[model samples]
Target: MFGPEGPSLRELAVQALSSVEHGYDLLAPKFDRTPFRTPGAVLDAVAGALAPAGPFGDGLDLCCGTGAGTELLTGLCHRSVTGVDFSAGMLEVARRRVRPAGGPGVAWVRGDARALPFTAAFDLVVSFGAFGHFLPGELPGLFRQVRSVLRPGGRFAFPVFAPPRPARAAFWTLLGFDAAMRVRNALWRPPFVMYYRTFRLGEVLGGLRDAGFGVELYPLPEFGWRADGSPRARLVAARRLTPRPAA
Candidate 1:
């Protein structure tokens, strides 16, 4: 339960127990009201980080959810913007709620991220808050799919925050959440399949390399830095410069 307009505890419980697609279908209407939605500040920061890279052509918001990332794309892409997700309910809410202010026309597609239905069509592809739904074993195929849809020299970008240290309460909280989800999936059918710790940065970079993306990280100064002097958040800017296999 995130707020007065957010899903109730019982509604969230029902969602967690359901299939990932259907769960989001049930939660879609209030998703933006929930903390699960990508925040406006993060969206603005991502748009700012990507500003110089753009005046891009057609764009795709992979797993766009309630369209926060889609809204972000409107400001960056020049021609058209598309939001793709497997959840019809979520897409329905996105269609009704989010509108592009000025840039490209908007389109919504209902499809799984693993098999994106487009070819080398998009100049930029961005995703937010959807990686946790994918298992570690799925990274190569997933990255390949993202790469497949991007044009030559196109970019796939997303922001990643550094994990909280073991000494921090946030670490324990996320660890506990992942543990509980594992137990729940072990006992339930059609697993929800979300894990906070599975998408390690090294592994992700490796997968991107294997998928043929020349990867780079830009510091998101909005989140400042860790005590170790490393960035607290980094924007992953992976570019597809040449042809590649389908993974």
Candidate 2:
């Protein structure tokens, strides 16, 4: 358990056994107290980096859980901001918990990210802490969906933290976590699909490019840099280059 407000060990176990959507539904009420929620530091850094680059007319938060990143979108978008997720429980918590005053009006939708319902509706799309739920093979279709939802020349942004170095304790910890997930999936139905190592930077860039995005990375200075001068955290800003063919 993370804290008094967070899910208990048994609660986490029950959630993990369910499908991703239902799992998040179970965890939604206490998600903010868990480490799984995107931290304020990352959200604030992203907002600062994006505010200068945009006053996007409309925004969407793909896989928005408990409205953490959706709140971030409110500050950047000039018009309405929508948060979409497959879990009704999570959206319920989001609508109740997040109240950003005097910015864009906010709404929540229940839908899957792989096949989002909107078409060229948002000027900007953002997500946080939701990628690992998607398998690497799902990236292309997922990126295509995001591209479809964005207007021509619109941007899809998300923050990606630099993976911990192999020499570090965190690296082994993540490795162990991923291996356990693989084993768990093999033994379980509805297979909770979260793997930290699958979403590499190179593969993701290629997927975005294939989905018609011209990608760029902005360093998040709050986290500093690695020994090789690589940024410890970088924001992926993928701009839609043109409209997809009508389908």
Candidate 3:
């Protein structure tokens, strides 16, 4: 258990045994109390980074579990904000919990991210701490889904933290977690697929390019730089390229 309000260790074990959707459903109520929720600091940094290009029209928060990113969108987007996720339980919680004053209208939709429901609708799309649920092979399709919903020249953005150095204890911790997950999935039915190391930055940029995005990366100076002098966190801003006019 993380704390009195957080899920007990037994609940986490049960959730780990369940499929991703069902597991999230079971955890949705106490999810924010757990360490898994995206931190407010991260959300604030993202909002600050995005404010310059924004006051965007419509926005979509992909896989918007409990509306952390969706809440941030209210301040950035001008017209409307939508949060979509496959878990109804999460959406229910998001609907009741997130209510920002004097911003864009908000809506919660339950749907799969890979096969998104809209086409060319939103001016901006953002996801946070959700990429690890997807496998590496799913990146192309996932990026395409994000691009498809974006208006011409619309942006799809997310933050990626610098991976821990190999020598660091954090690195081994993540490695061990991934290894345990692999073994768990290998033995369990309806696998809970969450792996931290699979989503590499280079592969993601390439996937965005293949999906017709003009990708850019901006350092989030709030997190400071790593020992190698690279940023500790960077926001990936992949804009959907406008189609050329017919000659």
Which candidate number has the best TM-score?
3
Question: Candidate 3 at 139: error in angstroms?
Answer: 0.9
Candidate 2 regions exceeding 4 Å error are: 243-247
Q: 43-94, model 2: which lDDT tens digit per residue?
A: 9999998998889999999999899889989889989999999999999999
When summed lDDT is taken over every stretch of 10 residues in candidate 3, the lowest stretch is 1-10
**Of the candidates numbered 2 and 3, which has the greater TM-score value?**
3
lDDT for each residue of candidate 3 in 20-100, tens digit (9 for 90 to 100): 999999999999999899999999999999999978999999999999999999999888999999998899999988998
State the lDDT at 13 in candidate 1: 98
Candidate 3's error at 112, in angstroms? 0.3
lDDT scores for all predictions?
Answer: 0.93, 0.93, 0.94
Q: Estimate the Cα RMSD of every predicted model relative to the unseen true structure.
A: 2.3, 2.1, 1.1
